[model samples]
Target: MNYEAFYQKSIEKPQEFWREEATMIDWDKPFEQVLDYSSAPRTRWFTGGTTNLCHNAVDRWLPTQAKTPALIAISTETDSERTYSFEQLHSEVNQVAAMLLSLGVKRGDRVLIYMPMVAEAVFVMLACARIGAVHVVVFGGFAASSLATRIDDATPALIVSTDAGSRGKKVVNYKQLLDEAIGLSEHEVPQVLLLSRGLVSTAIVDGRDVDYDTLRQAHLGAHVPVTWLEANDTSYILYTSGTTGKPKGIQRDVGGYAVALAASMKYIFSGKPGEVFFSTSDIGWVVGHSYIVYGPLLAGMATVLYEGLPTQPDPGVWWRIVEQYEVSLMFSAPTAIRVLKKYPLENMQKYDTSSLRTLFLAGEPLDKGTSEWISNALGVSVIDNYWQTETGWPILGVATGANGKKVPAGSSGVAVYGYQVSIVDDATGAECAANEKGMIMIEGPLPPGCFQTIFRSDQRFIDSYWKQHGDRWLYSSSDWGIRDSDNNYYVLGRSDDVINTAGHRLGTREIEECIAGHEAVSEVAVVGVVDPLKGQIPIAFVVPRSLEHVADDAGRAALRDALSKQVDNRVGSFARPSAIHFVEMLPKTRSGKLLRRSIQAMCEGREAGDISTLENPEALQKIDTIISANHG
Candidate 1:
């Protein structure tokens, strides 16, 4: 089906289409209206809905795809793999669900899941879905305080965790932190179902805490399905940082989520049961929920789940997993690619990536340099996609890069199967002409698979997304991008983060891409700082690949000079960085996103809020030192 026809069908007969799609699942109950757009800007798809996400993803697939492998776990250290069949996964999820219910978990109840890349972590999520409970999976690396905040918000009935999880060669004390977060909770703390990974230096299981193995054992004899969930029922609450504010919860509904995941999997993955679809996303994030847990499972495909860092044990860890599982569909972040690129290409040559049919990138926009490099290096085209916690899945992106549906560099490709996307000037809220950079917004309602709300912040949802625009349009993404003459969507950067100097708007991504193209540069992040001369000056924080060649001040200066020249050639000298700070590593969120705001804060000697979300918090101190040394 062509994109245009699919989009028209979705918008013109949205209700009928959604209802027809809902019939694809085995529902304990059916929905009333195919959709309820009466809410206006905060439109609800598949309104008056009734269904269970687990039943749709696992139960239905189990009957036919029972023997089909559903999950592939690549042990980070041992380099060994274990593939789980659909029947095996379904039974495990059922047992976990029975255990959860035994602990007082009920429909509409929330569960805090904090575990490593272990198989049980994935099971916990599907288990929640099986019993109509909402699962809030925090990244395994989150600090106690960060976990505390989320736990306090959702106030889950249970907290599923592990004693330890691997990161590189280090063992993270997950169980210890889980205790701390539970201790800090305002309400009666949720029970912690501890998985025995033995990652912690000191592990303990006391009252309100049971070993994950014991809990599963307790459910050794139960397989009952509590399928009372409705379509619009809250499946989970994934928290996201607001563009201009603090973190807000994005509520996803069971029915709508199932529909969206099915559509995305069938289209984005070009679904084939038993084929391995690997996405290196933390279970804490939305991508993990949509792709890692929901989408692949719904499609009855085997999804690879890795439990450690990419560089851990060795840089070739990811490549080895791909070869080990024959991962056919690989999705990861641009930052990861940048990291792996720093490693010797010979390392990649060690593995046979012939199984990889499609490569995907998200969490942030993909630059031309990385996209082109991946295309040439792996000989596989990168299908760079764009979406957010709000939209659920890729709303504006190329379906599959290997399908000869690729666009030019920088373009996020065209809108997905069923989305009406437009680039509009944020100042006027009017659609921009083709090739004009503007805020990307959706005109029609979101697909049924998108989030439902900001938890308790209905007014914030309206104010943040709706108030700026009239009731007619729903402002979704904070990204700045443009559509070319060929109708290809090219994402710039976040609107609030766009650099405007001498009235010419520049995206940080363009500058970052220019800086990354330099051979000396390993990874880079460009942020707009308040400038006395230009309204805002672009300052770059760079992590060089080889400190040996650029081992001294002279080498640093030479490297900066090369980067400056490259930026001048690519995006004009005016877009060149006011100054380049050489640091050991750029601070990144667990999801591999460079935290430019933190860099800007470090440059200004201000507090970098929520440093806990970072993978390496101490990296900021290095940035501070670099800034200090350069200024001195």
Candidate 2:
């Protein structure tokens, strides 16, 4: 069948369609049903099936792919490289599993992972899967407070961390942050496993901390078998920022997730076994979980786990890996591409990227300008996809599918199969007209591989996702999107205040709260401003309790510097505001609601539209003057 027919079958005959697709996965016990939607918008796919993610990703491929390179790990920060064959990976994963067992970790327990882009992190993840322990990976550089919030939520049985992780020449003290996070959390962990990178050192906490290598050495040559799980059993939890100012843990299931990723590898990426796959995303994000680690390995491809910035050690570092590994498939983000646009093309062209078949970009909207430039420069297909951390996979994207869909510029392509995607009116929840903008809605029963529910909160999942638009049962993406005549979807920015900075979705409320915590500030509004690079950046305007703190220009500068550092410590450095201006008042409406859109518009030098209800005109003018003076 062609792409349209394939998609129609998925919608019209979901039972037959999904059953056929489910064959791509390796299930220890076949499913009795393709889908059980009796309780949907909460669905359970491939019910009655038993499967192991580790077996599909590693052990099952051993007979055929054992000798081939399964994982290639590189770190420019440490100037090191290592490759593990499928057999080697299986053995190491087993060793790590044994180590976890020794630490009292068991099936269904949670292991909080705090490490960088290192091979050991991958081993621990696979090990957790091998023994059915759910792993929660916090982004390595997040501050103590952010980490502490996740700790209290997941309350892991164990924490796996490293001494430090390097960014450029600077080393981030991972142990310090983990120690602080543990101290702040209400839950007490039983054990902490440490991977001493020796890049930096810290005193191990006597009774709690244990050396990772020592445990691995004791369990060397051990074989830990896969722990089979029912299809609907929870696999892992990933935390994503919500408007409520706290991160929500997105729960994923076992069998359905495996089948979804298997189909993605074949139809979407069009990657073959023994070929190389490269994704420049940290393991902390959903993309890394799906593409960087699971999907490629399940397809029997060699996946690269890379560390270090794309520009560090020169812009050629990424391309060098591509040329060296002969990476056949690549996945990255638009923000990274935008940053690369500034550098000379020769930095990329010098490397022979002949093996690269397709380059996929996601996490943020892909603009036409950047899309066209990168496509022409690489002389390859640049496919853009759109999805959220909650979704766990793309909602709208282009792939080498049955129809060989033609990508329209500035759009994220058509909706993938199994998604009953529609552009709908925000207030009324009615479907929109052709070429009209609306909230992207999924009718119900979110496709396989999508999040099962919010961890520890079934009601929150229903309220936050299913019934976001009041009484509407549709799944609101909470993002503004427009559909073309051919059904190509263009994702405008987030409809809410979540800011996508370099593909990291940060809550504006989180940053504003961090800024407001400053004793010098009484009120603050944080807005995401447009950027030529990095997609968007946070900008803050603060109202001080006393002008004495910023009585002069020099005083104001000092206050700004202080607030910037405070955000760095309270949040992560990536969340630090690009600029913070001390203002006597923030622009507000007659109802005392802050005019965040107008504030953002002024920062971007755009027209502030429909401000008749704006109560304070001078407040906006003050911001305009501040922005103008900075540019002038």
Top candidate by TM-score: 1
* lDDT by candidate, in order shown: 0.79, 0.85
Candidate 1, lDDT over the whole model:
0.79
For model 1 the TM-score comes to 0.94
Highest lDDT among the candidates is held by which one? 2
Query: Model 1: which residue pairs collide?
Result: 49-231, 50-230, 50-231, 51-230, 194-212
Off by over 4 Å in 1: 77-80, 201-206, 241-246, 401-404, 468-471, 552-554
